[model samples]
Target: MTSFSANLGFLWADRSLPAAIRAARANGFDAVECHWPYETPVLDVKAALEETGFKMLGLNTRRGDVSKGENGLAALPEREDEARAAIDEAIDYANRTDTAAIHVMAGKASGPKAQATFLKNLDYAVTRTSRTILIEPLNRHDAPGYFLKNTTQARDIITKLAAPNLKLMFDCYHVARNEGDVLFRLQDLLPIVGHIQIASVPDRRAPDHGELHYPTVFSKIADLGWKKPIGAEYKPVSATEEGLDWMNSHLC
Candidate 1:
């Protein structure tokens, strides 16, 4: 039915994980996702999830050395050990928090070396955990030099790896910006897709202001038989709650 998941990463940066879960539940979100939850104790986040009955959709592995502009370690080649360690840490965190998936960032790597590293790390990741492991394609405009930059690349990697646990994190906003064939691409990629996220293209704001019509897209998702939560991964133009009228009417 295209249930909505609040992306606490963008939706409620001002609050703690527990508080954000409460806010998401109050706002009628069926589930919740986050970027990083390592700062907060897992018990508190788990307690909030239990209290709200909201699913913890997924979380990301830590972006290596944010100070040095390293986005992730998975594709760095030189950081293979660190990347595997990060994967193990993420699996532990997901298990502790009851998160269903883990989006392993590919960092700022490019070319064959990067691809090789990513493939090796992904192979290691799927072997270590039963939970879904996701690869998202960030738009070049928003994330220059990022290792993975398109759905096709992610799809190819997933295909080459042949890991049942590895899947795509299809962010509609990034796809639209990079490829622009949203509906058709969704049709092509839905089979291997594990999670879907949305935001206004160009502006990265709430979906209501986007070039894409989310209501239509949501309907299409339902028609395609997608049974997972559609992630609300957008920066609100104003207060996050103020921009949710569209979600309230459509998902809630």
Candidate 2:
């Protein structure tokens, strides 16, 4: 059977992190993931996870200043100190929350300088913790000027680093948008994928809609022998509960 992790960042936008974790448990999700939980008290989040018995599959490093439209710090040449600090903070949070991975966000900067900085930050990140460290490839459409925008680039970086702890965050929605061949890409890149996330393409809604056939995709993921939780990181078309009809249908 395919396992799903409710992305608390999207599912219960109006609720507190603890409440969102409780809701994910109630809603039949196998686990939960977060984009950023630094705003919440770690103990409170930890208590909720303990009570609910749901593992937080992963979370993200900070996105720097939202006011400045900074998507991440790791890839910015000038923000190396801040990037390292964000990594440390994420590691500390993951340790406290029992998260298995951290998606290190690469900010909206590109070029040799940015790449060098990202590699440096990644090198720093890998030595700090035993947990998986993920680098996601955001689509250019959604994240213009983003430093990391494709799986090929991410895969190459992972191969170059050769750090067992460093891996790719394969977000299907972004991949589908930027690369088009979701199943083929999934198969080709499964080796380096530390985590997988999903949403409908073009619309970024529930996986049941849009061009991607999620049932087939889910089956493909299973066939690939992926044991990690697949994150449902989509915006709800309606209320969170109401948009889960597709998931309910697949619960056999």
Local distance difference test values of all predictions, in order: 0.91, 0.92
What does candidate 1 score on TM? 0.97
Error of 1 at 31 (Å): 0.2
lDDT of 2 by residue, 107-224 (tens): 9998999999999999999999999999999998999999998999999899999999999999999999998999999999988988899999889998887899888898899989
The lowest-lDDT stretch of 10 consecutive residues in candidate 2 is 243-252
lDDT of 1 by residue, 1-252 (tens): 568899999998899999999999998889999998999999999999999998899999989999988888899988998999899999999999889999999999888999999999999999999999999998989889999989889999999999999999999999999999899999999999999999887898988766988888888898999988899999987787888887767543
Residue clash pairs of candidate 2: none
Runs in model 2 lying further than 4 Å from the true structure: none
Best by lDDT: 2
lDDT of 1: 0.91
Q: Report the Cα lDDT for residue 32, model 1.
A: 98
